[model samples]
Target: MAASRKVAVASVCLVLSLILLQFYVTSLHKELRAKILRAQITTFMSGLISLACWYLYRRLLAENHTVLACPSRLLWTLWKSVVICFLLCAQVTYATNLFFITTDPQWIAMVCYICLGTLIQLVCCLLVCDLIEIGLRVLRRGRQYQQNQISLKAQQTRTVVAILIALMLSARGLTVGLSPPPLKKVTIPMTKLPRSFDGLTVIQLSDIHLGPTVGRSRLQDVVDRAMATKPDVIVIAGDLVDSVVKKLGEAAEPLKQLQAPYGVYFITGNHEYYTGDVDAWFDKLRSLNVQVLHNEKAILQNHKQPEDTICLAGVDDNTADSFGYDGHGEHLDKALGSCDPDQPIILLAHKPSCAKRALQSKYNVNLVLSGHTHGGQLFPMIIAAYLVNPYYVGLYRVSDHAHVYVSPGTFYWGIPMRVFTSMEITHITLQATW
Candidate 1:
């Protein structure tokens, strides 16, 4: 009865997912009926591809003489069908997102993102299985010259190992998604000699994504960690919140507790524009006493020697122009305006690409801190992120005078998971070089 119920559930989910997928695609391209028809055809092709994956799995098992009992085989097929249903739902949700970028993510939307992540994991496992099978076949053909078949036990062992690896990957995804980020300490050296600011610690919290996935408690955890470090200065590189100010205003309340001797600073990230009103978030952060650095600079003066100083500057996200928000986007010259060219400056920009810009600029920007990439967020995707980002993660020296450190994000983005990567809060200690 349980098996039958599982099959029925899979069938229902598959049908509903298909209906939603068609509706979303049709809605998006309603003006072009021919394009909609082509999308429907593509959807049919995707179904065939899923069916082919299952067929290959069955054939591989049978060829290796590792086929399970009738009931077990039936259960396996039902599970595969359920996975297909999940993939369909995920694709539909992504399609819907393109049309309707909600101010706040709904629970259903979160589920879809999770489903999408699981589907990708499943695809990776399938690829591994195929590669293993191909390797085993090559070994079998080689042994055929001696007229000896490969051991069935060996084949079974390979299958078990592959499945175990896949399960471990899935578990890792869950672990990263549910856990709080650990603190990572980093030290940077500056060329200009400033005895007073030496050993000054700066705690960086970037890509917090304070929203449905990351709630008040999560932000509080991050704040507590930052406070524990007793930083002289605190900086939020960007991506403070994912949702609109109205819906997630209270979620960021814990940020008020994030105090530092030099005060907390913030700059705009591309996500700020996505919330529809950049000003609302800016106002909200200001209310918390967090300094908003909108294309400007502030000098940290040394008390003993008032003339000795270090400049801290920040620019808007590079995407601000496409977003069309007022007073937004990277304006390096405006941000460094009035600053002494020889003064040691630390710059904050959401995307690491800004490091290259800082290197080209005449301003004496010693270091640039960023966190837009999230260090690829998950496996295989990291490989894709590398193609676009010159500095994907960790500290990278852009030039002799300029260096960039890209944080692996303090939290996950759309999906509440991290695989093969851990979330982090960075503590950068500055040491002066004479």
Candidate 2:
């Protein structure tokens, strides 16, 4: 908790520095000078609203004593609340007037795209502007032309160029964020993979995050794309929805269409426990005929050659135990205990950090699939994601016998933007090296 708070404080300081940088850059223009005060007020109000939302969310979590009483769960809730509140405040600040006009989700989303997109553009442009200024300083070192002084025309030109760069990048980011996740084909050669199970294709969809911005239409499109692949098995590693069943269940109805030769399986992501109704989501997915794996295993066999079989095991999110939910905790032992040691094992965990533990376990787990990092989801932020996750995205060969694949995500969450990262539907094929 203390560490999280310190990180939060550092983030606040960085944001303040960025705001100050924004003011300094804008002051160079006479027209923008007048708008600085207004911008400052907007930022202040946004901060206040974010604080209020954070407090309320924390209080709400506290009220849910059964789920969030634990220190770890509270800490997670608080951190999530901070992020959600910050984004909400950004949207509200950016679309202040639009909220009065209509409560439509589309309009709100449009406002979010425009506002957040513009903010991202502005931040990038400012950074570029600073870099240009620094380079000019370096070039002019020891020269007689007043140091730290740049002509208005030069500044304006630099700003214009930065704006152009920002526009291009933001446009690409929004396009990628809004588009259907592309299918990413990956083949993992397993030394112990059974001959019959060779060439087994599994489609992985993780972090779909169906909520206000991403809904039924988007989900349907993803489902259609996955079906087109004709995979042998389909797996939703975790984070399928961001909201409760009552809110996004209809949007998730497309899951019923996901069928494969083996089956469609799901495991809990941290977001599931955050929804405060993990069991409800389990029931909902089960109703859709999606096998919900809770620290359990399912034996996949080639009906034609019943002896050619493998174990497919899935565990709950790493943080599930912290949420104090009964029958919900990541238990690799329980999931893999009954599996035949000789047969290859494929484990599905939501977070990549679990890959290390799975590999170190007694079982000869051949492959592990996960997706929680979202490939960092945004620029600069991806750096943080990389630092935290052992495996950020894509395939990693942990050992000669084991491999791990981390998908960026099926879709994004919050802000409706994906800067340097992309959404993906991972299609993995298992090949027998033996």
lDDT of 2 by residue, 1-434 (tens): 99999999999999999877765744453324324434555577567545544543443333333323336866766755654654564547434332321211355655554455545555656566768877876776553564534434455566557656866877788888878788888989997787888899999999987764677888888899999999999999998876567777777888999999999999988877656566788899999999998999999999789988889999899765654456668899999999999888999999998877888888899889999999888776798999999998999998898999999999886556788898898989899999
lDDT of 1 by residue, 155-220 (tens): 556555655675577668878877888889998888784888899999998988866556787788
- Candidate 1, residue 350: lDDT: 88
Measured with C-alpha atoms, the lDDT of residue 318 in candidate 1 is 75
| Cand. 2 Cα-lDDT | 0.76
Candidate that scores best on lDDT? 2
Candidate 1, residue 17: Cα displacement in angstroms equals 29
lDDT by candidate, in order shown: 0.75, 0.76
Residue 13's C-alpha lDDT in candidate 1?
100
**Worst 10-residue stretch by lDDT in candidate 1?**
29-38
Q: Which pairs of residues clash in candidate 1, taking residues 3 or more apart in a chain or in different chains?
A: none
Candidate 2: clashing pairs of residues: none
| Candidate whose TM-score is highest | 1
